[model samples]
Target: MKVFSICHVSIVMLSIIIISTNLMIPFYTVVAAETNCSNGDIVIAQSRVGTLPSGIPSFSVEITNACARGCSISNLHLKCGMFASAVLVNPKIFKRQDVDDCLVNGGSPLAAGSTISFKYANSFQYPLSLASATCG
Candidate 1:
C-alpha cells in the first residue's frame, strides 16, 4: 500500500509539471494577458514615421512598459497580410523581421518604463493602390 501511494503521488506531480509547461506558452513572462498597454496601464506606444518610394510611408513602432511590474506581450503580431503588401510594393519589406538587438543591447531585458522598438519599411509605386494592409 505504501509503494502504491508513492507511485500515485509521483504520477500526479509529473502531470502537473507537464501541464505547467504547456500553460507557459500562453501566460509566459513576455507579455501577460492581464497587461493592457492601452487602458491607462502607464504604457505607451510610439513610432517614427518615414517615407519610401517618394510616395509610400512606413512607421517604425515601439511599445514601452511604464509600470513597475514586469509584463509579457503574447500574440503581439503585426497586422495580418501586411507582408504581401510590402512584397507587392517593394519585394523587400518585412513587418516583423528579426531586428538587430542593438536597441536593447543584444537582448537586454527591458525594465519598467523601458522601451522596445521595431523597424519596418514600406514603399509603393508612384500610383499608390491599397494592397491590403493590416495596420491603421
Candidate 2:
C-alpha cells in the first residue's frame, strides 16, 4: 500500500465533505419547508370595552403571540364606530402611549404565549347605545 501525505489526505477528505454538504442542502431546505412555520404566528381579536382613567368610554383589542418566537406590532390601524339607533360616534384612540410608542420602539414585540392590548377611548355616556368599535 502507498502512504498519502497528511496535506493530500486532508484536502481529499475536505472535498468529499463539501460535496456531501452541497448535495444535502436542498434536502434540508425541503424538510424545513415541510415543517409548519405558519403555525407560529400572531392573533388579534376584539376584546372588550371599559372606562378610561379620565372618565371616558374606552375599548380594547387583544393581541396574543401564538408564534414560537417573538411577534412584532406595527402600523396597527385602529378605527372606531358606534351603532346606536342610527347614531354616529367617531371614537378616537387615546394614543398618547401608542403614538409615542411607535416612534420610540418600532415594531413592539411580544414573547411567545404573551398577550398585549391596545385601548381606544371616547366620551360616550351610558345608555347611549353605542354598539361596536373596530380595531385592526
Candidate 3:
C-alpha cells in the first residue's frame, strides 16, 4: 500500500509539471512576439553635410529600421520642434504635422535594415527624436 501511494504521488507531480509547462508555452510566445520591436529600434542619425547657397547649414539625416527580429515599422513620428528647412525637403519624405510632431515616409512602412535619408538646411540642426512607431 505504501509503495503504491508513493508511485501515485510521483505520477501526479509529473503530470502537474507537464500541464503547467504546456500552458506557459503560448504565453511566452505571445510575449516574445510583442517584444520583438519598439520605437527604440528606429535609429536616427544627422550629420552636417555643407552650407547651402543661402548660407544655411545643410544637414543629412538618415533614418534606419534596426529591428532585431526583422520586423517592419510604419507610421513613424518624430519629435521635431518647429521643424523647418531652408532647402526643399520633399513633403512625401518628411512633413510637419504640429509644433513638435513630424511624420516620416508619408506614414508608410520602413522595412527591416532599410534606411531613408534626406537633406535639410537650417541655422542649426534640429534634434530629431523617435517619438512613436508601429511594428509588424
Candidate 4:
C-alpha cells in the first residue's frame, strides 16, 4: 500500500508539471507573434564625408532597419524641412515629398538588418527624424 501511494503522488506531480508547461506554451507563442517593428527601429545615421567642388560640405546618410525580430518596414517618411543637397540624390532612394516631409527607399519595404545609403552636399546636416513607417 505504501509503495502504491508513493507512486500515485509522483504521477500526480508529473501530470501537474506537464499541464502547466502546456498551458504556458500558448502564452509564449502569443507574445512572440505580437513582436513588431516601430519607427524607432528605423535608424538613420548621417555624417560629414568630405567637401564638394562647389565649396559645400558633403554628408553621407545611412538608413538601417534594426528590427530585432526580422520584421520589415515600409513607406518610411522623414521630417526633412526644406531639405536640399547640391549633390543629386537618387529619387529612387530618397526624395522630398513636401516642405516638411521626405520619402525614403521609394516607399518600399526595407528588410530587417538592411541599410540604404546616400550622399548629399549641404552646409549642414539635415535634422532628419522618423515621421512614420508601416511594419510587417
TM-score per prediction, in order, is 0.32, 0.32, 0.73, 0.74
Question: Whose TM-score is higher: candidate 3's or candidate 4's?
Answer: 4
Off by over 4 Å in 3: 1-35
List model 2 lDDT by residue over 1-136, tens digit each.
Answer: 1111111111111222356556432221121211121322445565437765666666555656564533333333322233121122223221222321211112343445666555545565212111111111
| CA-lDDT, candidates in order | 0.33, 0.34, 0.79, 0.78
**CA deviation > 4 Å runs, candidate 1:** 1-44, 70-109, 123-136
> Lowest-scoring 10 consecutive residues by lDDT in candidate 4?
1-10
Worst 10 residues of 2 by lDDT: 1-10
Question: Over the stretch 3-110, how does candidate 3's per-residue lDDT look in tens digits?
Answer: 100111111112223565564322211223332566668899999999978788999999999877677787888999999999889989999999888999998989
lDDT of 1 at 84: 26
Taking the tens digit of each residue's C-alpha lDDT, what string does model 1 give over 1-136?
0010011111111222346556423222322123222223223343537676755666554545454434422222222232323323221222323321011213233344666554544553121111111100
Q: Candidate 4 on 1-136: residue-level lDDT in tens?
A: 0010011111111222356456432221122233366556889999999998888999999999998877777788888999999979999999999987899999898989999999999998899888877776
Model 2 TM-score on a 0 to 1 scale: 0.32
For candidate 4, give the lDDT. Answer: 0.78
Backbone Cα, N, C clashes tallied per candidate? 5, 0, 0, 0
Question: TM-score: which candidate is best?
Answer: 4
Clashing pairs in 4: none
Deviation from native of the Cα of residue 114 in model 3, angstroms: 0.5
**Angstrom error at residue 94, model 4:** 0.5
